[model samples]
Target: ALDQEKKQIEKEMESLNLAKFERLILEKQFRVLSYLIEDKKEKVNIVSCDELNNLLEVLEQKKQRRQDIKSHLDSLNKELACSNFDFEKAMLYRDLIDSEKKRLETVNLSIQQLEEKLAEFERN
Candidate 1:
């Protein structure tokens, strides 16, 4: 019957659409992963759920590192504030604080970029 044929065609079209959508998601994941792994030389063919989980883990580690650097910087600031004498020690603390600040900035930028990429991937 024509009705049966039409129904079969519709089911095939639905299946094809689902497959296309899944492929699109995988492609997006691959692109995001590639961007995140810019420094690595390994070639990535397909992105999997495990890769996304790894990305989340990396993001969390970066956040923890940022917090650690912030706390260390605070301690250095307190030390610098309390030390009225020993100019060399104060200068050393200042240098350490400066380096920590720079590191924090780098981590913050990295986190921002990752979040933006994840958001974009979700949106698409």
Candidate 2:
């Protein structure tokens, strides 16, 4: 029954590996959800199904806001291009564009930081 014991051990190893993989996925999801939900005061270590659904809704809202900002920025760029002959309007558009660019850069940096944190968390 040595062969039987060997097969049992292999099966147990596979099960353990699967459990670890699932845990990693859950942890990553939790981190992302928590990071994106910026207004929440408490950290959620273990999320219920309903909470996950709420987090997903929040994610969609944030995505929509980002899209709106991008669309506004694009329109500003177009306006800037068309208003080159009007010096005052052109300068105003340029300033607006600069502010939007800075905002976008800040958002990008926050995302980068979150990813770095996730990687560090995984390493530990």
Q: Candidate 1 regions off by >4 Å?
A: 1-50
- Give the range of the ten consecutive residues with the poorest summed lDDT in model 1: 38-47
lDDT of 1 by residue, 1-124 (tens): 6446646755665566465335434433443343345313112211334255555666776687678768867876886787683776566567667767887897799788767766766677
Best by TM-score: 1
lDDT (tens digit, per residue) of candidate 2 on 20-52? 335434433443343345424212421333244
Which residue pairs of candidate 1 clash? none
lDDT of each: 0.60, 0.52
RMSD of each: 22.6, 20.5
Model 1's TM-score against the true structure: 0.58
Model 2's alpha-carbon lDDT is 0.52
- Model 2: ten consecutive residues of lowest lDDT: 41-50
Clashes of 1: 0
Which pairs of residues collide in model 2? none
